[model samples]
Target: MSKVFAKRLFDGESWLTNQQVTLSGNVIESIMTVEVPSADAQSVDVLAPGFIDVHVNGGGGALFNHTPTLAALQRMVEVHAQYGTVAMMPTLISDDYEIMSQAHQTVCQALTENMGGILGLHYEGPYLNPVRKGVHNESKLRKPTEGKLADLLDVCRLSKLMVTLAPEQVPEDFIEWLTAEGAIVCIGHSAATYDQARQAVESGAKGFTHLFNAMTPLVSREPGVVGAALQTDKPTWCGLIADGHHVHPATMRVAIAAKGCEHMLLVTDAIQSVGSDEKEMAFLGKKVLRSNGRVTTEDGTLAGSDLDMATAVRNTVSLIGRTEAEALQMASLRPAEFLGIDKEFGRIKVGYRGSLVALTDDFFVEATWIDGQKVWG
Candidate 1:
């Protein structure tokens, strides 16, 4: 068992001060407020539930599409750990079947080995709409065939799966099939109308890949995918790239105001340049440049991002005018809830995993712990 003492602890819902959290093995055992700190407790300024990112393309000077190996995945995990990401879905962009198969195998291998910070996989797709492909390979974009769907479903048994697809590209019951298979279905890279997007959510699509990017825009007469995202009474969550480049601060404020912070999630959408000081990296045979806190191609096409999870949480407070607790919730609790792993993964409550991060007063990550063991500092 282990004990952690933080000046403040964000226990998934709200902040508690001067508390001691006990952990046994990988799960939290108990938490209690203390007037005098425990003698053996590890102390920190602020402790929070480790960030759970659902839309990570690449990091640590390695792009998953390029390497698709366990070593590459481990490097991504170690690099992102420094930024306080305890768990992530190593996302693969639109690629051929062979590469996708390799990625699936690699994630399975990581899970089999019980690798820390490897939480299944995310395929951001070969089944996306070509019109809004963004940095994805348009040549690889295609509808899901029965064989391909079966192959993907097979991999879901090895680990959790989050598949991002265009509602317009796949068959009528595609989203339902994915949901039934226990994979989280996210709608993205589409040009779907509002009704179509809403229907997909009604059909079991639980989230949007990255809101307000590469998807259809909201028009006064015709409410598009963005409109469906902003609507109420639907349980769909929208993942927002909070790097301040993919979205304007004013626009992010509007989204939080409309949908409320409960439905808004913070995602890095980070690419290879995130961990290293490199200014350039290759993506799908195209050169990507990192500048002014954004990554873009020569023609000014936004590839992914240089943002990290800790930075995204900080931006949520500074740029979006939200509380630190709310910002932390978007990065951790909400994403876990969206993935249906909240009961075990998203809190400092009893029985939850002892995955947590310590941040300084300015929100910089001071250290990180996964399963009660320190991983990065």
Candidate 2:
């Protein structure tokens, strides 16, 4: 049976009305907006593709570092599902070697259960620049060695593994090695020079972890990784945390002024504290206090954010001077393309999965559908 949604549809290119939709099991069977419903109609505010969050460490107060349990994954899933994020990746930051292995294995198993839209996993680090470690455990960060890379890739195995590392930290000889292994290599938490970053970009690095944080700053003389990332030729997509703190509404206007939205991706980089009223939460084996909505550690180092997929979408549109559809693409379409999963998840089409979000005028998620099922509304 297919579910009909009220209002407009993203349609991948533009929003249109007079639509009718049909779902068969876990996929959208048909979408006919101009026709009348045949008896069973499930109308909603506005139907858009389900948001794809690539960097989610924790949710519902369960930190991935604290416990990457199936129950914790469920909590994270439920929290974001309410916010219209039907698909997400469980992210883990720099931690002990055992913890890292456990986290990776846990995500692989979770994907087996296929809770709603758990597409894959994002391992933020084990290899990173200690000087730019942000809130990650600095002591656990290490230079990428041949033996370690082998073991790590084996752990990633058949799961979608997105690794954020400093190109400078990893041996230059291994650039092609990681790329050849089908790893979604993202440059982040690095202080690499422009040339170093450019070389990695050419080697098949597709994106950045979180733009403008814990990474090299763009300079006139050096140009840094930011400049290389925003480079037009063989450029890398920048994952931006648009929580208004991690990045200001105005900076995005300037940052993407020339590069455009296609060069940028919206990542919440959300931590365990999301969906909570408590002022602070635990991070990096310490209690990170949040005052004035800024999440930071006791040492004053900035930590992961508290925003969800829905908040990021709304903020990108309402605050960042982008249309709702435009912001929504950054959350879903653009990210899917960045991960090379666009054909299946980003757009609303005949063969694509029927994961979608229905939002009100204010951009808040009103209803969410995962694989043709009404999971939240």
The 0-to-1 C-alpha lDDT of every candidate, in the order given, reads 0.89, 0.81
Compute the lDDT of residue 354 as modeled in candidate 1. 89
Instruction: Return the TM-score for candidate 2, rounded to 2 decimals.
Output: 0.95
Residue 350 in model 1: shift from native, Å?
A: 1.9
Per lDDT, the best of the predicted structures is: 1
- Deviation of model 2 at 173, angstroms: 2.1
- lDDT per residue (tens digit) for residues 270-373 in model 1: 89999888988788899998899989999999998899999999999999999998999999999888877898777889889989999998899998888877
Model 1: runs farther than 4 Å from truth? none
RMSD to the hidden true structure, all candidates: 1.2, 1.7
Question: Candidates' TM-scores?
Answer: 0.97, 0.95
Please state the error at residue 4 of candidate 1 in Å. 1.8
* Residue pairs in clash, model 1: none
What is the alpha-carbon lDDT of model 1 when measured against the actual structure?
A: 0.89
